[model samples]
Target: MKKLFTPFMLGSYRLTHRVVMPPLTRMRAGTDGVASPLAATYYSQRATEGGLIIAEASQISQQGQGYPHTPGIYTQNQIAGWKIVTEAVKSQGAIFFLQLWHVGRISHSSFQKDGALPVAPSAIQPAGNAFTSTGQRVSFETPRALELNEIQQIVDDYRRAAENAKQAGFHGIEIHAANGYLLQQFLEDKTNHRNDRYGGSIENRARLLFEVLDAVLEVWPNDRVGVRLSPFNDVGDISDSDPLELYTHVIKVLSARGIGYLHLIEPQVRSGLVEDMNHEAPPSVATLFRPHFSGPLIVSGGFDADTTEQALAAGTADLVAFGRAFIANPDLPKRLELGAPLNVPDKSTIYGGAERGYTDYPRIDEIGVNTSE
Candidate 1:
């Protein structure tokens, strides 16, 4: 467990500890998809010196959005808004990576530009609900299948978003291909039924991801870029007939590319969410697939300190990311180091809210509580 707090070099930047803050969308951005001032305060409070913070999923284009008030990276206002966020995180000496996102079939026309249907690899309706403008969760609608030309445009959006992240002062960028988002929709066999060059075979399913990566690499070096994947994530109507073969190939391809790191949401969220909603079952160890990739592997889901210790000790994960834990404890790393008590997060205020639960979670010192006796 102590080993996790030890400094490690990730590409050019050296992280102080392996306790990473994975991207968590707070839906606090403005209606224009511009990050608000509160967003800056929210992130800066959690920033730690030499730590890594992957910012919340930000839509790469207006068409990329699926939820209300989620931030975007395409417009000038959006870029300018993010500048404040990146500068705030960097000022505290933490490295910030913007998670570029596109929600594909996981959206409704209410969130789409010009009321057009959401686009996806196939005209499939994901079995899930999306947050709408009225703050209501509505069922997902069937998406429009993307043409070859339109696919190219989406890749360009990713490229331009990466460039915009650089302009906004982000140290690096993370491509969100996980959790049944746009890229994952294209990767999974169930959602992607296209007969084009981007579908059918395993190689074809992964084509769009690589194309977007290639475009992103043009803006940043391979070492400054990373991709997030969920080999067994069932959310957003995602599934693969042969996950092991599919993911092994994907990992091998990424390993060869020598990208900085690979962030994976372990399979814990599958059957684990039902038993104990508070405890996310630890993701199945990916040690079996470790040999397929040589770059850093960061595993995230529901991980306690002991589990984090075991994962690092067993060499299953290089870094452990905490989402809900970080939300409740702004000084998470410090609390862990001191073995301090954590603040229980208010589930109600997690999504669209102000400081009530966003930045009001008190640190140990602020409340004068010490659990590390």
Candidate 2:
């Protein structure tokens, strides 16, 4: 049997397989920022016994929101909405995790309360468009640099959000520090131009991330917390002067803390775009960071069954995360094991839609395959 199909121990949990479903944002939530009822069905359809699933990125506070209809965990209604999702996923005996997110400068004022400008580590304007509350693409605004006291508030927000996830029945939490979001805005040099404790040197720039992790760790054990990072992929037009040095320090500290896992996005896959599997790549991100991170490492971005198995066999990645493939194949593990065909995902319905592209994907058995024969 392939290593991808074999059982593996992640922290204290025994996973039946190494195939993980990473967080994918589908803007199907209501204007109140509560998850749709269909979200429960969507997640339960993909859950497998002893498998791991990281649900979509959810805002930790109203200030953390950047896009329309994305779920939030701060409100009572939001917590109740996610409780249903967790219950459905738990019914399948799978380990469910919620990815905590704060979009930082990747926002327009329209999405903020009182139409306040988005906040980031600095008041820099990223070179991209922001999605408005009405789904219009508007130019990115120069974000307000978070005040020294305000930084502590954001940290508190993360802690409160972690508590909310626990209330929502999540087994764990994954901090969204990757893909040029708020946390990454603080990590990279281009986005963070502050002279305070949160900027300048590599250690200073990484202070906010460490602070957020420490805050979240206060709510749950370190072993139940995961941190996701994108060292090479430059989404949000953000980059660091020396990614290797920065991530090396980050991974080493995380290793020392003995977190549950370290999830890295492969360099080949750009954020918010369909992956080009045939693209040539440099040394794999997993291989580069494997030696530094002592805990279980999950590598996401454009991985199929063959590559996933190869990654596990090579010991470069303890687990592999599939985003798009899993979006189209609800029973992805069974399909991969049976060598069955997968459904093609409709890009048009990937975000802010109802049940069509979200939970309607057919299982292998439903496709008229008879594995029992």
Candidate 3:
């Protein structure tokens, strides 16, 4: 457990610990893609030492947006707004990174320019509901297939977003290639059916993702940048013919680029092996890239304190990220250090639930018990 607080280099910045605040979609921004005051306060409270905080996914450009009030990095107003956030986090001894994102067909026409259907690799539509501008939940529309030349424009958007993020006072940027978004749309065979150089074979399917990474890397040195990949366990109607093979090929290619670290969201960790013997945990795509990647790896999704400590001890992953737990317990590291019980989060407030389930989650001390910070 003491090793979790040890300092290490995650690319260019020397992090005080391996505990990372993974990019969770906290839908608390203004319509113009600006961080709200609540968002600022929400992050400020969780600010602490030896932890690297990656802000929620923000759109690279207006066309990159899908969810309502998810924030953006394309405009001055947006950058200025995020500067308030990064500055606040840094002031309290926490380093912050902006997660650059593009939702692709995961968006609705009601959210696009002149109600245009969102653009994706092909005309395939994802099965999901998107939050509309009016805060209404709407279904996603089939996206327009992107032309070859048009792809370059999107790649350029990532580069410009990286530049904007740096100017916005963020310490670094994380390319949101995970969780069934634009990059995921292209990486998965079911979503990408193009026959051009950007499609077909693994290299072709991985072309756009690599190109976007190339564009962003042009602005951000490999050290100051990181990329997240979710190769298996499809959520958001995202799946490939062979997810493991596709991700290994992709990781083998991207890992060589020397980005900060490849964050892997792994299978659910068991609690006392559960009584259900028929049910087993799923496997992670990390095993495929384990031999391919040489940099530090951060693991996320469905992890508890014990599993996290165990993973680090077994060297399966260098870092562990807690999502729901982090949201409920601002003093997560401290609580874990003390082996204290955690505050169970109310599922209702997971998104757009206001302060009740958002920032109001009490620390261990708020319940009449105290833990040193």
Q: Model 1's lDDT to the true fold?
A: 0.87
**Model 1: per-residue lDDT, tens digit, 1-373?**
4988998889999999999999998888999999989988899999999999999999998889888878999999999999998889999999999999998887778888789999999998877576666678777788899998889999999999999999999999999998888999999899999999999999999999999999999999998999998887677767888888898999999999999999988766532112212123223736657788899999888789998998999888899999988988999999988888788889888888788899889988889886658
Model 2 Cα lDDT, one tens digit per residue, 86-143:
9999999999999999999998899888999999999999887889999998889999
Query: How many residue pairs clash per model?
Result: 0, 0, 0
lDDT of 3 by residue, 119-201 (tens): 99999877657667777866677789999989999999999999999998888889988777889888888899999998899
By lDDT, the candidates rank as 2, 1, 3
Q: Alpha carbon lDDT of residue 229, candidate 3?
A: 80
Model 2 pairs whose backbones collide: none
State every prediction's TM-score relative to the real structure: 0.95, 0.97, 0.92
Which 10 residues in a row give candidate 2 its minimum summed lDDT?
Answer: 273-282
Ranking of models by TM-score = 2, 1, 3
Off by over 4 Å in 2: 273-281
Model 3 root mean square deviation, Cα atoms = 3.8
